[model samples]
Structures are given as structure tokens and as C-alpha cells.
Target: MLCDNERGVSLGTVGLKVLTSKDAKKVYAGIVAAGLRAKETVLETAEKVQASASDVLAEAQEINEARNEEIFEENK
Candidate 1:
């Protein structure tokens, strides 16, 4: 099931069932489309998280450098 996959469970024993009947093709298509959309959302969110983390790291480095410069100036 999707829950097992989402939770990082091993799916060796899992069985996937997507109706492939002539009348069910549209249903299968909709399911695939929805899954693709969800994947896109997760990717976008991960990118945002990475960008925010990098920004915070850069700010901290800048602050530390400024403090070091101030100390160096005082010692001169």
C-alpha cells in the first residue's frame, strides 16, 4: 500500500493492483497522474527546505567572520 511505501517499508512482499481492464484504463490514468503530482509536490518542498538551510548556514558564517574581523581589528 501507499502507506507502507511512504513509511520506507521494504516492498519485496508487496503486491500492487492497478485495474487494467478496458473500462478501468481511465481510472488507472487518474491514479498515475495523482501520484506524479504528489511526487512533484514533495520535490518542490525539498528544494525549498534545502534553500532555507543554506541561507541560514551562510548567515551564521557571515556573523562569525564579522566577529573575527572585529577581534582582529582590536588586536591591531
Candidate 2:
């Protein structure tokens, strides 16, 4: 038998349980905590990627400048 309660659904005698208010609060807290942790992880990865990209751009600029100097010298 399946029914809807004010809080959640009830499935009778199949070992399924409904969330009481307290249990619901705990579940909500857990979900929030997980979301925070995931956000932190994503932010950390983004920072690392940004730093790496900056380094690559700097290196590429240096190489281009060196090549420009070589061409200028050859034309002299």
C-alpha cells in the first residue's frame, strides 16, 4: 500500500520509512554540507587551472618575443 502523508510518502510494511521532521532536518543539513564540500572542491580545481593557464600564456609570450628579436636581428 502506498499513501502520501503531510511530510512524505508511506509504503506500508515493505521496510520503507518516511522522514519525520527531525529526520528531514538532518537530511537537509547533510545535503547542504555535501553541496558546500563540492563547491569548495570545484573552486580549488578552478584556481589551479587558472594558474596553469596564466603560466602557459606567460611562456608563450616570452617565446613570441624571442622570435621577434631573432627576426629583427636577421633583417639588420
Candidate 3:
């Protein structure tokens, strides 16, 4: 959409049309709503990934602690 050559019309021409069109306001509103929805989806996915990473780290720490205790007992 940012690139202007495919439609045989320049970006300036399209911008002008969108600005003056009767339903321009509605079109812009829809664009804004779609963008907000996308942003929300991205944030939710990022939170899930962070939670999974934290869980894996906790499991790793437990394994390491168990290994250390085994080594200490073997030495004694």
C-alpha cells in the first residue's frame, strides 16, 4: 500500500481521494480498529512466551540443585 506504482496512481492521488471521499471517516475508523486488534494479539502472545520461559528456568534450577546435593553426599 505504501508503494505507489502497482495501481498506476501515485500515493498523492490516492491520499487526496481518501481525504475527500464521502466514507473516508469510516474507512479510517476501520483501519484504526484493525490496528488496535492486531496490537492486542501481539501483546497476548508475548506474555504467554514469557510465562513459558519462566517455567523452564524454574525446572532447570531444581535439576541443578538436586545434582549438587548428590555430589555433596557422594564426597561425605
Candidate 4:
């Protein structure tokens, strides 16, 4: 019996079990699917963070080089 529960494993009666071996397999599958989706989200977030850091580093390097060039010109 299907119930309006998130896990789909709701007991119909006081002595009834909703989960059998097959039901366990489906639950496992759902867990695996959720894990994969979470992993994908983590990977995507990491990529965005890495890219932002790279851009910031590049900008800092450019600013440092400009400062160095100005210092050399002053020394000359």
C-alpha cells in the first residue's frame, strides 16, 4: 500500500511492515541517486570557487606587476 510519505514506506496497520527485500532495494536505489546528485552539486560548487580564486589571483598579479614597473621607473 502506497502512502503519502517521502520514503514510501508507511505501515498500513499496527502489525504491518511496508518494507520488504524489494522495497529495501528501491530505497537503496533512491539513496544512491540522491548521493550522486549531491556529489554533482559539490563538484560544480568547487569548480566555481576555484575559478573565482583564479580570477582574483590573476588580478592581484597584474596589480603587483604594475606597482613593480612604477617602482623601477622611479629608481631609474
Better of 1 and 2 by TM-score: 2
Q: Give the TM-scores of the predictions, in the order they appear.
A: 0.66, 0.74, 0.71, 0.72
With a 3 Å backbone cut-off (N, CA, C), the pairs that clash in candidate 4 are none
The candidate maximizing TM-score is 2
Worst 10 residues of 4 by lDDT: 6-15
**What C-alpha lDDT does candidate 3 achieve relative to the native structure?**
0.91
Report the C-alpha lDDT of model 1 over 1-76, residue by residue, as the tens digit: 4686665544433322234455578887888999999999999999999999999999999999999999999999
Superior by lDDT: candidate 3 or candidate 4: 3
Backbone clash total for model 3 is: 0
Judge candidate 2 against the unseen true structure and give its global Cα lDDT, from 0 to 1.
0.82
Error of 3 at 22 (Å): 4.7
Clashes of each: 0, 0, 0, 0
Residue range 1-76, candidate 4, lDDT tens digits: 4447733433344224444467777998999999999999999999999999999999999999999999999999
lDDT string for model 2 (1-76, tens) is 4346623533443234445566777998999999999999999999999999999999999999999999999999
In angstroms, give how far residue 17 of model 4 lies from its true place.
Answer: 13
List the candidate 3 regions with Cα displacement exceeding 4 Å: 1-22
Better of 2 and 3 by TM-score: 2
